[model samples]
Target: MRKNEDNKNIAVIYWSNSENTEIMAEKISNGIDETGQKADLYNVSQFPIERIEDYDKVALGCPSMDGEALEKNTFEPFFEEIESKLKGKKVALFGSYGWGNGEWMRDWEDRIGHTGARLFDEGLMIKEFPDDAGRHACVEFGKAFASF
Candidate 1:
């Protein structure tokens, strides 16, 4: 675990079609705040990929589309642009889904891992709208990631 005085900067960027992922992103930021770490939250549309290298930790959120992976329009390009910048960073993933198994999260984890970023924990996922348990889990994920 990193020392509390490390002062690492963390960022959470998310794209949400139905607002669920956005709420999760806020919860993640809250968890990071609880640990007394600095966190920045941004919508994927406004996320500055060029600045990713300035952060020590990053958490990305995207809803599943067509039972496949991240929403294509914003997330795909954003991810691609930042992939090469992620080596050796601490990262986490989260998303909301309406249907299908959680294969999207697994695939995303694999892809991010390939970039050499250490995943903080298993990716956080929710079926449709997340319930209380799921939100709490996301918060825990944030706390754990901050400490990593």
Candidate 2:
């Protein structure tokens, strides 16, 4: 069955330093498009945190920064501001990392969950740049999130 018009709006927001995370965001958007839906992609700096409330679904992508943490400047503040509003929202997370295990993603998931956002599924973490397999996973991730 096709999604209703109201269910089609999705926001894909991310912060990328090496551009790896942005690539992943685009792949996820491609997946969303494959599902016959479109998502507005935004760099965290450009997207208004309050506008997160406008979309029915949100997929946030950000690479791990110093000590496996969210990018300190843009993505972090954006996430912190919109977190409380995530209550009852449908959301997903994905990103790339240069080192360390996916501890950043784990903490992020737990933090978002505590705010009451309904997670679309497990978070997706790709090391360094996303290769073909990782991109494919991102597409599938987007498709799954769209399904939700």
| Candidate number with greatest lDDT | 2
TM-scores, one per candidate: 0.93, 0.93
Model 1, span 1-148: residue lDDT tens: 2323476778899999997898899888888878888678899888767779778889999989875688988888899999989999999999999887888999999998899988877888888776798788778888888888
Local distance difference test values of all predictions, in order: 0.85, 0.88
- Candidate 2, backbone clash total: 0
Report lDDT (Cα) of residue 116, candidate 2: 91
For model 2, what is the error of residue 133's alpha carbon versus the real structure, in angstroms, after optimal superposition?
1.2
Report the C-alpha lDDT of model 2 over 22-124, residue by residue, as the tens digit.
9999999889888888888888888976687787788999998999999997888888899888887889999999999999999999998899988977789
- Quote the positional error of residue 25 for candidate 2 in Å: 0.1
Task: Tell me, by TM-score, which candidate is best.
Answer: 2
